[model samples]
Target: MSLLKEKILQVASDLFQTRGINSTGVDTIVAVAGTTKMTLYKHFHSKEGLIIEVLNEHYRHFHAWLSERLDRKKPAERLQKLFDFIEEWVSSPDFHGMAFLKASAEFPDASSPIHELSNTHSQQFRRYLAELAADAGIADAEGLALQLSLLIEGAMQAEQIKRGSGAIVYAKKAANILIKSSLR
Candidate 1:
């Protein structure tokens, strides 16, 4: 990516994550990025285009972070590691729920690109969980993955609503029960 484009994306991602998609305008993005609207348009074509790129960037960063944390763990431990990471994440001061979930809420129209991208991001994460479950020798990996995915989503919402309470701790306990039951 071009240096200017990268800067724009970083600035936009920070603003969008902190503020929101609809609340942060192009003018603010340009101003913070130290680039003009014309330059942003030249690089991204439009604000929606920029938003899509920002979403993509967010997914990339999220996936990289998750992978780095879980890759070294054994297949059976991966799920636990995932929940551990989430627990720490929700406890952190910077926690603000899932960015994709926030984006989906902002763009409720199912046909919208932002909405579709957010859905794709979620499905991809679920697929990853399913793969891990299968590798761990679970018989119903798909079902287990779906259940775990629900727990993760529920924890995110609960944390958001409760402002980073013990939702993840409970979620992790539920996940452990699910994993034990599934293995049996």
Candidate 2:
């Protein structure tokens, strides 16, 4: 990406994540990006287009971060590492709940591109969890993945709404019990 485009994306992503997709306008993005509407349109056809790009960028960043943390760990260890990462993530000052969830909330129509993109991001995460479960020799890998994914999503919402880190800690404990039972 060009410098201008990169700046636009950065500013837009930050604003969208902090403020909201519907709440943040093109003018504000351009102003923050230090660019013009023309430049933004040149890079992204419209605000929806820019939002799709932002969602993709967010997924890329998240996948990279997750891969780095879980790559070297054993399959069994990866499950625990995931919760550890989530704890750190929810506890961070920059944490502002799941961007994908926010986008889904803003665009509730399943046919909407923004909503689909958000769903895609979520499904990808669930698939990753499934892969990890399979690698760990779990018999019902997909089932376990679904369960874990629910726990993760719930914990994220709880942390954001409750403004505390206890959700993740409880989630981790629940996950441990689930894993142990599944292994036997």
Candidate 3:
């Protein structure tokens, strides 16, 4: 990405995550990016296009972060690391709610490209969780994955709505119990 495009993407991603997709305006993004509407359109074509790019960026960065945290750990230790990753994530000062979750809510139309991108990211996340569960020798890997995904999502929401409420801590305990019972 060019410097201008990178700046626009960073500003838009931050604004969208902090404010919201629907509430944020192209003008504001351009202003923050220190660019013009023409430049934004030159890069992204339209706001929806920009939104999709932002979602893609989030997906890439998140997967990279997750891979770093989980890839080196032993299979049995992966779940523990997963919980630790999420706890630290939710506590970070830059912590914002899940971008996919926010996008899906803001663009509820099932047929919309924005919604599709968000849903795809979510399904990919669930699949990644199932992979982790399988690696851990869980008896019902898919079931365990679903349980863990929901727990993580709920914990994130709790942190967004009730910061410092120990939601992630509770989530980790519940996750351990679920993992223990699911072990083959």
Candidate 4:
């Protein structure tokens, strides 16, 4: 990303995450980015366009972070690392539910670019989960991975609603149980 685009993404991601996609205006992003209106419009056709890009950036960064931590780990550790990662994310000061979830909820229709990008990121997560589960030798790995993915998503939402990270404990426990059962 260019310096300007990076700045714009940072400012817009913060604003959109904190304020919301529909509530946040392009001017707010441009002003925060310290750039001109033309520059903003030049890069993104409109606020919706920018919002989609911001969501994509979030997914890209998130996947990068996960890959960095997970790609080098042994199979068992990688599975646990997945749990740990979500736990930490839920407890982070910046926790604001799942960004993709929130964005898709704001615009349920799949036609919106933001909604589409959110779905794409979500599918990527599932694919990663499947790979991890298979690598761990879990029985019916693909199906089990989907279940685990849904469980993690649920845990995140529960933690967000409860305003604490404790809900992740259940997810961890559930994953352990699933692994054991699959082995049997």
Candidate 5:
């Protein structure tokens, strides 16, 4: 990405996460990004295109982080690391729920690129969980992975809703138990 494009994505991500996707106009993003409408449109075809790029950037960062943490570890340990990652996210200073979750909630239709990206991210998470479960030799890796994914995703929302008081604590405990039991 060019410097200008990177700057725009960063500004757009911050604005979309804070003010929301629908409400944050392109002009606001360009202004905050220290650019002009011509530059913005030159880099991204439209506001919707910009939104897609923002989501893609976020997902790329998050996926890289998760992959780095869980790479080539024992299945159980990798699973634990995933939980730890979630805890870190919960404790992040700007943890206003998940950006994708918030975006999907704001735009429920599957026709949009935002919704498609959200579903793609969800699929990636499921695949990661399934791989870990299989490496652990779980009887039904697919099923277990789905359950574990749901638990982690649910706990994230729960933490955000409850303001992260004890949500991570409960989620970690529940996740560990689920992983252990699934391996048995």
Candidate 6:
């Protein structure tokens, strides 16, 4: 990416997360990004196009962070590491709930590209979990993946409401039970 494009994305991403996607305008992005509207248009074409790139870029960073938290140890340990990292993430001060969930809430149109990208990001994560479960010799890796996905989502929501108090404890315990049962 060009220097100008990267700057625009960074500014827009911070503004979007802090304010909101729908609330943040192209003009504001350009102002914070220290670029002209023409430059942004030349690179992203439109606000929607910029939003798509911002989301796609967020996914790349999120995936890299999640990957770093996992190891190639026993399959169950790999998942447990993921669960622990999630708890850490939720507890972090920077976490403002799931970014995709926030984006989806802002763009409720199911047919929209933003919504589709949000869902795709989630499905990809679930598939990654399923891969872990399958490697652990679980009989129904898909089922386990869904179960874990729900737990993670629920925990995020709970953290939003409860401000990160005790949600992870229950989530971690439930994950252990779910993973244990799947191995049997």
C-alpha positional error of residue 139 in candidate 2 after TM-score superposition, expressed in Å: 0.6
My TM-score estimates for the predictions, one after another, are 0.93, 0.95, 0.96, 0.92, 0.92, 0.91
Question: Which digits, one per residue and each the tens of the lDDT, describe model 3 over residues 1-184?
Answer: 7999999999999999899999999999999989899999999978999999999998888888888888889987797689999888778888888888889989999999999998999999999999888887787889999999999999888887767888999999999998888873
lDDT of 2 by residue, 41-133 (tens): 999988999999988998898788878889989876787688898788778887778888888999999999999998999999999999989
Predicted structure 6: lDDT:
0.85
Clashing pairs counted in every model: 0, 0, 0, 0, 0, 0
Q: What are the per-residue Cα lDDT tens digits for candidate 6 across 146-178?
A: 999999988887887668467888888999999
List model 1 lDDT by residue over 6-34, tens digit each: 99999998898788889999999999999
**Alpha-carbon error at 31 in model 4, in Å?**
1.8
Q: How accurate is candidate 4 locally (lDDT)?
A: 0.83
Q: Which residue runs of candidate 1 sit more than 4 Å off their true CA positions? A: none
Error of 6 at 4 (Å): 1.9
Q: Tell me the lDDT of candidate 1.
A: 0.88
Over the stretch 1-184, how does candidate 5's per-residue lDDT look in tens digits?
6999899999999989878889999889989999899999899898888888888778788778778777866655776677788788678887767767777787799997788788888888788788878877778888988988788778777866777477777778987898788767
lDDT of each: 0.88, 0.89, 0.89, 0.83, 0.81, 0.85
Best by TM-score: 3
How far off is residue 132 in model 6, in Å?
1.2
Give the Cα error of residue 70 in candidate 4, in Å. Answer: 1.3
Model 6 deviation from native, Cα RMSD in Å:
1.7
| Residue 13 displacement in candidate 1 (angstroms) | 1.1
Name the lDDT of candidate 2. 0.89
Give the candidates in order of lDDT, highest first: 3, 2, 1, 6, 4, 5
lDDT (10s digit) by residue, model 4, range 49-162: 888788878878777877788888998667767888878767888877778988988999989777787888889899999888888877787888888988888987787677
